[model samples]
Every structure is written in C-alpha cells, then in structure tokens.
Target: MTGHGSGDLRERPRVLVIAEAANPEWVSVPLVGWSLATALRDVADVHIVTQVRNREAFLRAGEVEGESFTAIDSEALARPMWKLGEALRMGQGKGWTMMQAVAALSYPHFERLVWKTFGADLEAGRFDVVHRVTPLSPTAPSPLAAKCAGVGVPFVMGPLNGGVPWPKGFDAERRREKEWLSYLRGAYKALPGRRATLRHASAIITGSRHTASEVPDAFAEKCVYIPENGIDPARFSLVADPQGDVLRACFVGRMVPYKGPDMLLEAALPLLKAGRMRIEMIGDGPMLPGLKAFAEAEGVAGQIGFHGWLAHERVQEVMAGCHLLSFPSVREFGGGVVLEAMALGVVPMIVDYAGPGELVDARLGIKVAIGTRAEIVEGFGAALRRAAESPQALCRMSAAGRDEIAARFTWARKAEQVREVYDWVLGRSEKPAPFG
Candidate 1:
C-alpha cells in the first residue's frame, strides 16, 4: 500500500525497531541503538525489540516492557557464547574481532527468536517497517531482512559500519588490538545469508563510505548514507569557553595504541613546552602509564592534565573548558566523541580519514591528513600551531561547529533523516539522497 495523497504528507509509519544491544546506560553501539530507536518514536509509531540484557535499563528509562518495547531472551545461546568470547578474548578489551566473531555466531539465534515472536504481526501488516539498528558491523548478516521481505513488509538495516581496513602503517597496532578475524573480514560477504540480507533489505543504510563501498553493485540502488553516531543536545548543553590564553585541548577515548594518545602527546610536546597549549587527556587504558611517564619525562606534566575516564558529564565538563579536541586516532569507525566535542563548541583537530573525515570539514574544524606515525605527528603539530596562531579562526570554528552539530548531528536530526527512508520505503516519495 502506498502513502497519503501528498508524498510528504502521510500517517506515522509503524516501525518494529530491532536493537539487540540497545542500552541507554551504555556507550558505543548499544547507545547508538537506544538513542536512534527512541528518537524515531517522535516521527513514527515505534515499538522497540531489544535483547533481554537491556530490559532493566529500558524499564529504568521508563519504557513499558510490553507496550513500548519487548525483550526477547535469546540467552539460551547468547549467554554461553558471551562467556566463551570473554574466556577467549586474550586480554581485556583486546581481541575485539574474536568477540565479534562470537557475536556473529550467536546473533542469528536472537533473530530466529525475534522472527518467532514478531512474524505474525509483520505478515498481518501490523507494522509498516522492520528496522535493525544494532549489530552495527557490516560483518553481521541479518536473516530477518529476508524474513521481512517474505512477509511483504519493508526491512531497513544499518547505518551499518565497520571493517575499516587498518591503514598501511598500523600493523603493529593492529596486532595489539587482537584483530585476527579482520584479516579474513571480507569473507563475511560470502557468508550464507549475506547476499539475501542485502537483496531483501528495502533500504540499506551505510554508516561510512568504506561500508557503503562494501555493498555489492547488484544491491547498490537501495543504499542510504547516514553516519552511525549522533549527539544528544541535553547532555552536551554547555558551550565551551575558549577564552584562555593558552590553547586548551582535550583528547578523549581509550588510551589504546590505535587511538594514538601518545601520538597526540608527541605532536603537542613542543606546544606544551612553549606554554602555547595545555592538553587534557580524558580516558584510561594500558597506554595511560606510558603517556603519563612521557609527560613527566618531558617535564610538561604540569601542562597536561590526565583525568582518567571521567563520567560522561564530567568528561564534557572538562571538554567544555577547552578550546579544541585533539583526537588523532588512526582508525575510528564512528568518531562519536568528535560530534560531542563539536556540539559543545570544541572544534576538533582529528586525523582526516574514516569517520572524522566524513564528519568534520574545513568549515567546522581541522582535519590532519591520514599518514604514517611521523607524518601524523608532524601534521597534528602543524595544526596545533595554526590553532594557537589564530584564536579568531578558532573562535569562528567553535561557533560554526556547534551550530552545525545542532543543525545536523543531533539524534533528533538523525531520526528525521531516517524518517525520509521510511517515507521512501513506504512508496510515499522518491528515495532520499542524504549525501547529495
């Protein structure tokens, strides 16, 4: 069935949002799932279906278990699989590929159960759309896509992102992250249900250009480009005060090898010594000790304040007092923190590749070209110098970045973008070209 007479004018589409990892209390994929699904409620009649693990969080967030959302317990398979992944993870927060491999193995069981629970309603045309918001990795194929297609309902999957190949010089970093499965990551495209998932999805929302490129030529027509990360304005309401004489910058994220916290220090050392910049390091990991040692060894410890893993609000509080976010991570899939910094009027100076490249442009913030370790350090150093030399330009970027975040990167704005996909899939209008 088509929509109301005017394509732009239509009833609220009923959507069954499947977010197996959705948790309001969590960060990353779970937060992405929870935020986007709830935001969609403003534009559509949405009923969230999430894994049992997030049930309590959902209830705490005031969602009615049965009416507003449903929790499917796939724990029979999921629990054991999770335990196995933990046991084999090699080290804490390492071996991500192994964990995701374990997840890919267990997730289908969840979907099978989701189909068992929601099949009837979908077949009966009770919902206008079936949207899978989690398992954000493009590596995980959805059998539910084909199932929804068979039931004659539209299926939307993604903003699916991941499989950003480690850049040329980060092999040592790659090994440290325990990304063994990534070597064979492309093989997921050949997995049993992948083609069917892509072929059947009414709209495929890709979160990055790398992910969008992964879509087979045969199914490219249905793809939509929307970044996976967005900021909540309420949480990041404080505007940054960039009035300090020294350029104050903050680096947020796990102090892991790939995140390049050390690289940031190497680049900023000259500025720190000259008292041209003061850096705030937020977050903790194995690299924290080394970073602190480096700061002390350089005698610039006083210039760099290391606040290890502050609460989200506190992180923003620290960030709000700063002028720039210096995040030079070599590999990032979504770069959610960049958006958060922008929302707070903290202009980001990030490596111009992958997620940050897509998110920040010349107008909003600075982009250091992606390169080898030395090149990146030099680039970030130069960018830091430029930021210091021109406080006027920095102030302009502070205002522009915050304004851009409000206009485009908020969860509410992202939901409206998804609504356009809903309208297109329901035959209400021409397909949306979000990039164009």
Candidate 2:
C-alpha cells in the first residue's frame, strides 16, 4: 500500500482545483475541496482557486501544507441591480426569468469569459491536471476545463449532484416533476456551455453510483465514483455521553427549500408532543422563519432549540451530544454532516434520497422513504418513534455507524482512492481499479 506522504517520483503530480468556493466552513463544495487537498497533498502540489464567501473563517482554517489556495472574488458575479432585473423578469415569467434563459442560451459565451480570466493562469503550464470540485454553476464556467484541455492539462470535473435525476423509487410527485421539467428546460436554455465542458474533461467524479448513472451519455465513460465529501475519523470518534437526558436529534446544513428541514420538524413535532424526543436545529437559512412559525403552531416550540450558524467545530460538539442526525433533503450530492455524525457514533436518519441513501446502510443508519410530502412526514415520524422506543437499538446503530466509517469512509481511504484516479490520468500502468 502507498503511504500518505510517500514523495516517490510517481507521486508529486502538480494539480489545480477550481470551484465556486473551497472553505471547510462553506459546506459541500468546501468539504470536497478540503478532502481533495488533504488526499492529494502527498502525491500532488494542489492549488485551489475558489470564491471566498467568508474571508476570515477561510483564512483561520489555514492551508494544507502541500496545497496552495487562491480566492476568486465572485462579488463581481452578484451584481445586485442585474439580479433585481433578473428577479423581476423571473416573476413576470411565473418564477422564470429571461436573463437566466439568456444565460443558458449563451452558456458558451459565459464559459469563454471564465477561460479568458482563469485560463491565462493555467496557460503557464505549472499544473499537470486541473480539477473542478463542482461543475454546472453559472458562477464557474465549464469552458475553463476546455481551456485546461487546450493547455494539455487533464481536467477532472465533479462531485456534482442535484442536477442529475433523483434515484429510482425516489421520484418526485407529478406537480414537482412538472416543475422540475420546467426548471430543466430553463437550465438547458440558460447554460449552453455544458457540452463543451464535458467534452474537455478527462474524468468526472460523482458522489455515488446513483449519481454516476446520471452522467450524460457522451461523458458517461469518463465518470468515476468518488464520495465528494468526507470526515476526519480521528477528530470525530464515538464518544457517547450518557448524562444527556434528552434523546437530542440534530439537523445541520443550509436551510433551503429542497433541503427538507421542515420535513424533519414536522416529523419531530408529534414525537415532541408525545414527550418522546427533543430536537436541536443547528443551522440557518431562508426556511427558518417558516419552520420556527410551524414549530410554534405545532406547540412544540419548547421541545426544539434553534442554534443559527454554529462554526464547524461547534457543530461537532453539538453532534457529540445528539443521539441521532436527521436530514430529509429532497436533493443532495453527499451529506457531509451525515458522515460527521456517523463518525461520532450518532446514527443518521436520512430521507431515501441521493446522498444520504448512498451513505447510510441499514447497519449504520435508517433511511426513510420519500415520495409525497405526506409520505415523507409519515416515514420520518415512524423512524423517530422507533428510535425513541429502542435505546439499545440506537446504540447498536451508532456503534455500527462508527465502525462503518472506520472501515470504509475515512479521508485517508478516500484520498488513496483519489490518488489512484490521478495515477490513471497520468497514463500509469499501475492504475487502481474503479471502486466497486
């Protein structure tokens, strides 16, 4: 087996990573960036160019020794007046805007702009490979990969989720499906650069086999299955706290419309009413106002605690106290918090959606079916009830969850797998086989 810091001549490949953001504090993309940086450090001089959302938090997190960091100012992309006009147009079109439509149609032009700006840096030939952690964002042009291709640099695009169709048995309702079709049409209309992007990429990293199955047929051959996010097992271990009375269940991550935080609340409300569990929501987002209102209306306000925007370490501490982590997002690539909780022996209860379902096996955690809103609510409610009634079962699941992480999902292991991809891209004969 190759050691972490072998520094053999076969190692030390120079690579550049481009993403919208790359802070550990920035959720999914950052988690991907951090893990990749750490994994590739021994084998590559990794340089990450990403948008900086929070400058201080990013700086304080420090850098991976063999990795270099560059912050791309994306404030230029967030033109408020332009956004206002776009929003007005979208409202006029029934939540669909013409600018977005135009953007989609002119995606090639957008990709050109990205190349003009970031391509010059890569043209210097300092890096052998270019990896984009997240693709399909308007903010980061896919054409950048094409630029890398022009410079003879292998471009790896990925860890992409959400854009792909949901897995089988997890279909959206008719109404939602219609809405999704409209959104897909708009996406195609708005992002013309996708084909060119895929054409230039040497490989595409997907979070799971489920996501890999959704890769465009043209690029399907180049798709590689890799968990886009991971946890440091040493930092997050199974240290059960016996004194905590409330079987505290926590949900952490951005509170967005599709994230399904409200579903978790709805499921927990009846359990709280029955005096079965206490809930702690340790994140903030647009859904907070409505979720808070719903909690009050359900008369379970006292049983729920909302901790808005806790830092990453604070979140780990919160996970330590919690008995289970509940995430009911309709769309996700990989749930970083799910792995974090599992590493800490907090069994996960996730919606049977893309990311969580892929990560949470029966031994490690529970998966609730997600069909309709009512079905989601009922499924989660039943899981919560089962967890509340069986303390021993929770403990068993928690232990299994930690063991699973140690056996299969550590950053070190994930890094080794990624190094194999790097070796394959380098035209080496000693390529590691595709993960089963």
lDDT string for model 2 (1-436, tens) is 0113445476476777665445566555556666666566666666666554534555677653223565554454434534654554533222222344433343334345445555766687667777776443322337677677788888877665544354444344223322334335424523455667777878777777765665578777787777666777656754655344456788887675566788888877878887778887988866689888998998999888888888767777877788888888776656777888888888888887777877887878899986877788889988888878865568888889788777767877776677677777778645455664
lDDT of each: 0.90, 0.67
Candidate 2 ranges with C-alpha deviation above 4 Å: 1-9, 51-67, 70-126, 136-141, 164-182, 185-191, 233-238, 242-246, 254-257, 286-299, 430-432
lDDT for model 2 comes to 0.67
lDDT value, residue 226 of candidate 1 = 91
Q: Pick the candidate with the highest TM-score.
A: 1
- The worst-scoring run of ten residues by lDDT in candidate 2 lies at 173-182
Residue-level lDDT of model 1, residues 186-205, one tens digit each, is 88889888888899999999
Candidate 1: residue pairs that collide: none
- For candidate 1, the lDDT comes to 0.90
Which candidate has the highest lDDT of all?
Answer: 1
